[model samples]
Target: MGQDQDTLSVVALCQSERVLWMPDGSPHSPRFKDRYRSRSGGLAQAMTVFLAGAGLPVGWRGRNRFSVLETGFGLGLNFLCTWAAWEADPQRCERLQFASVEAFPVSAADLVRSARNAGPEDQPECSIALRLPVLAEQLAQVWQGLSPGIHQWRFAGGRVQLTLAVGEVQATLQDLDCQADAVYLDGFSPALNPQMWSAQTLHLVAQHCRPGATLATYTVARSVRERLRQLGFSVEKCPGLPPKRDRLQAVLRP
Candidate 1:
């Protein structure tokens, strides 16, 4: 932990962030020249690609505490959905920790708008969407405190925790000290945002994973799979949401 804190001391915070809105209500990143999340629906992508792929709800069930680490905190859709799921589940873990590293943090207004636009209307069956606005409001309330380095926020009467590392992905991941049970590899596509998926960055991610920790991502790019395998994760290509051919799911070998 001391080492991690030392790393955080030297890292820089995100700067000059902007999220562009499309006609269809999707958020696009002008810097990456790509959408913040899947056009099919951010909530849908979170459910199908990240939650289901990581065996969430079930994976976190019966555990005293579960942690999820994410590569990008774009709009925080994944975090909101996970928090809602934990709230609704009777068998949820007593504590949930979501840690994410972001080089660019969007404004509080953009976070709220992105979340409001990506709600139950996008996927009516998603119960999380029903409570999204309330949850997002809670998030926005504390969003202003977000600066560079590490900021921790507690919600759900302190049972849910968010540890946000606002800096470059590789450096931020190295500074994060948590044994994550699941991982969400979310960001722009590798072609557009290579730093988030680079071997060194992924290796830093692996260093924070407990044995048998699971990981999921919307991209099943061959290079990603190969790199993960070389790092000791059993990677597989899974069926993806509409307009996406496949997604990647991996588990660290014991």
Candidate 2:
């Protein structure tokens, strides 16, 4: 209904099928369908759609520094999952930097409530939620301190740097100095969230990618695949999670 400092309020159109609202603040995905507005892609969706699609865990094994850029920090599910994977992996990259952009941010209490509701079966999910003592508290404390620019938060001995870009998608992406090794495209679907998936936005993301950079999302729209191709990404269709037949994955080709 409205916008917050870092969380954008989006109405869930499909609840039975678990489709949440679309993502708005990032370009990694042309259109991010909630599939369950309440939880916004839940744990399975994120693990299958973005993480598996991008070839993570395995992808982060050897690199010294691994950077993941995401749009829509909703509930911080994707972020927590990614971080847990990194922490659990012995071969994980030495430095893990996760940068996400969101226009409306919810309160830390809300995040905790969401995670608790998500349940214990969601191991990494609940684990990350419970383990978030200092960082999560800091996030809650500074929820209202967000302004229209880049805000950096360091955690886990400063190895994890979360940069919140607080503005419109295009403007924020333009202002960030991020060259991502992996991009998590979690925007609302193009039909409902056009601005996030516009061709121009993809181009901007491409500009920030070094050759061979990878991108993944849960959308298989023709326009999205074509746009990514136009931006120098080699696109492919892969098996999606339950219900969805195919999702898109692309690699930046020099």
Best by TM-score: 1
State the lDDT at 37 in candidate 2. 23
- Model 2 segments more than 4 A misplaced: 1-41, 119-142
Q: Mind giving the per-residue lDDT tens digits that candidate 1 earns over 60-133?
A: 99999999999999899999989988899999999999999876788888888977888548357767888777
In model 2, state the lDDT of residue 130.
52
Error of 1 at 66 (Å): 0.2
User: Model 2, 1-254: lDDT tens per residue?
Assistant: 12222223221211111222234322122123333221323556666777777788898888888889887675666776677667767888888888877654555665544444443353654554454343445456655555557888776677767777866677789998898988988766666677778898888888878788889988899989999998889999998765778888999997
Per-candidate Cα lDDT values, in order, are 0.87, 0.67
- The TM-scores of all predictions, comma-separated, are 0.93, 0.79
- Backbone collisions counted per model: 0, 24
Give candidates' CA RMSD values in order.
Answer: 4.3, 7.0
